[model samples]
Target: MDLINNLALGLGVAFTAQNLLYAFVGCLLGTVIGVLPGLGPLATIAMLLPVTYSLPPLAALIMLAGIYYGAQYGGSTTAILVNLPGESSSVVTALDGYQMARKGRAGPALAAAGIGSFIAGTVGTLVLAAFAVPLTAVAFKFGPAEYFSLMVLGLIGAVVLSSGSLLKAIAMIVLGLLIGTIGTDVNSGMERYSFGLPDLSDGIGFLVIAMGIFGFGDIIKNLSDKGTKRELFTKKVENLMPTRKDFKLMLPAVLRGTTLGSMLGILPGGGALLSAFAAYSVEKKIRLQPGEVPLGQGNIRGVAGPESANNAGAQTSFIPMLTLGIPANAVMALMVGAMTIHNIQPGPQVMTSNPELFWGLIASMWIGNLMLVVLNLPLVGIWIKLLTVPYRWLFPAIVMFCAIGVYSTNNNTFDIWMLGLFGIIGYGFVKLGCEPAPLLLGLILGPMMEENLRRALLLSRGEWSVIITRPLSAVLLAAALVMLVVVLLPSVKRKREEAFVED
Candidate 1:
């Protein structure tokens, strides 16, 4: 009954004309960005952050959230058509999706992706709505010690789940913590690393860092790759609807992916990309039907499974952000920054104090999923048409928009300079085979972790044992330790690397 009413309230708020229009606009724009190569949700969301400052918080977030999942929906289009992944998570989709296109089954491949996404999005949202309330209850019992331990677990998970050298991931996280410490000390009245500059007093703006790394840095990487030839598959797509047998094959994969994604997404740092990769890997090991294509050779299960998991993960990743005020990934980190800008503090209080905003965002997701499917299936031809625009022509417009957006934050040149500095660092990360997502997560969580640790120590009269003595905190810390140990083991590490195969 409570769930019914909360959903009713959410629907009421989300159905407003203004919210609906922005949701549509956001879905449309997200699909375009997703269909195009060289642009993903991180860069697009960061580029658009400044523009949301003037809008209502609910509307702003609804639109931004649409971009995240809409990109998930749109990403498979390019993967199937041109063998390109519009987003990182879609990389797994290209394996079988493009093969399906090669065999003139492009239409069915795309349909499976769309339908799988729709089902998965619905299931993920339902799980989110069901689980968020209980998680909020559990969060209320957390002391500073427990909160600090939870963040420790989150960081460990970020490092462990990341698809790269664990040493590099750890180093990147440490660097992010160092960068996070640049502001005035909250406990002390003195500035620590500001170099006596007034601009550093407030620390680096989250938007500035985001735009610099994801926006400028991404553009720099794309431009650095000289004269790349993008092969556009001009195969005509016929029969855009999946047959009954096709649906039967995909349904089981979709169900399994949805379940896996919903569970993984609630964990800190486990979201769409990880879920998608894991799902595809799992599908590869499973037994195939008598007449079905093998994995990576136009298997419809490959397209359906990863696509479903990807969408499910995208939706449910909001659990920690809304329920516990912890962002699970880079896009959610940007959401945390956006929430701060809107003066809407994320956490348990959101459910009680801002129920309308909470539920409205939830309801809008259902509507957004419908809009995405409607846009993706029937209009895929139009999206394939987007394949023709050379990335060289797109980068300039993206760069210009990023510049204007960052400047709009303070109407100053300093942030733009900071943007340039981080862009260079971001490109360096790309060159060094380092993944930047963990850094963003560490940077966002570092300050909060420090604050909680200080408060915990202060409450314990400077006793460190309180952290390990508390049951929940102790368990969380132990889990982090166990995860780290597993990742460090040579045999396990080798298998882990094989599981995350890039091709």
Candidate 2:
């Protein structure tokens, strides 16, 4: 009954005219971005962060959230119609999806993806709504020691699950922590790393870092690559409905994928990309029907499973961010930045203090998923048409928008210079085969970690053992230690690397 009332309240806010309009616009933009190859939700959201400054907080968040999940719907379009995947999570989709297209069954493959995504998205949203409050209740029990330990666990989880060298990931986290230290000290009232520059006084703006690293950096990297010709599988898509046999196979796969994705999405470093890969691996292990197609050979189950998992994962990844103030992935880190921009501190208090924002954001997701299904199925032709626009035209426009967005934030030339510097630095990271997600995570969590550590020590009269004495904090730290040990094991390390291999 309480859930019903909360959802009713949420619906009331989500159904408002302004909120609905932003949701629609977000879904539209997300689909277009997803249809276009090489553009992901992270870069798009980073480019648009400044634009949200003018929007009401609820509306801004609703739109950004729409872009994140709606991309899951649009990504499958290109994967099925062409061999290219529009989003990283969609890479697995192109395997069987393109094979199905090649076999003249593109329509069914697309329909499967769309239907699976909608169902999975809806389920994921319900899970989020159900779990967020309970988790928030638990979060309320945390003290400074526990909070600090939790963050330590989060960073360790990031290192364990991140896709590259453990040493590089740790190095990136340290660099981010160092970068985070650059500005005025909250307690000391003195400059730490300003180097006498007024612009450095406030520390690096999250917007500048986000736009430079993701938006501009991606554009520069894309420009460096030689253009490859994209082959469209079908000029005209027909039979948009799936057959009974298709439904029989996809339904079970969708259920399994949704379950797996929902669980994984809640874990640190586990999001849509990882969920999709894990789902694909799970599907491969299940025995096939006698006449059914093989895993990568135009199987409808392949199209449905990973698509469902990715969408589910994307939605549920918001759990930790909204409830615990811990970002489960890089995109969630940006969301933390978004919330701070509105002067809203994320965590357990948000539900009690701002019920409207909490419930409304949750409610809008259901509407957005419905909107995506409506947009994707009937408007398939339009999305395919968008694929023909050349990268030459798109790249310059993205670069321009990124510049304009960054410069408009502070109207300062120094920010632009910093943007350029970071863009080059971001590109360097790409060149060095380093993942930047952990760095962003570290930067966002660094100050909070430091503050919590200081508070814990102060409360304990400077006893370092306070961390190990508290049961909750000790358990968390123990979990982090176990994670570190598990990941370091030779067998586990090899399997971890294998899981992240794209091909």
Per-residue lDDT over 311-360 for candidate 2, one digit per residue giving the tens place of the 0 to 100 score: 99999999999999999888899899889888899999999999999999
> What's the TM for model 2?
0.98
lDDT of 1 at 237: 79
> Pick by lDDT: which candidate is best?
2
Show pairs that collide, candidate 2: none
lDDT of each: 0.90, 0.91
Give the per-residue lDDT digits (tens) of candidate 1, residues 176-247: 888899989989878979998888887887878888888888889988888657677665678888889888
TM-score of 1: 0.98
Model 1 spans > 4 angstroms off: none
How many clashes (backbone N, Cα, C below 3 Å) per candidate?
A: 0, 0
- What are the root-mean-square deviations of the candidates from the true structure over C-alphas? 1.2, 1.1
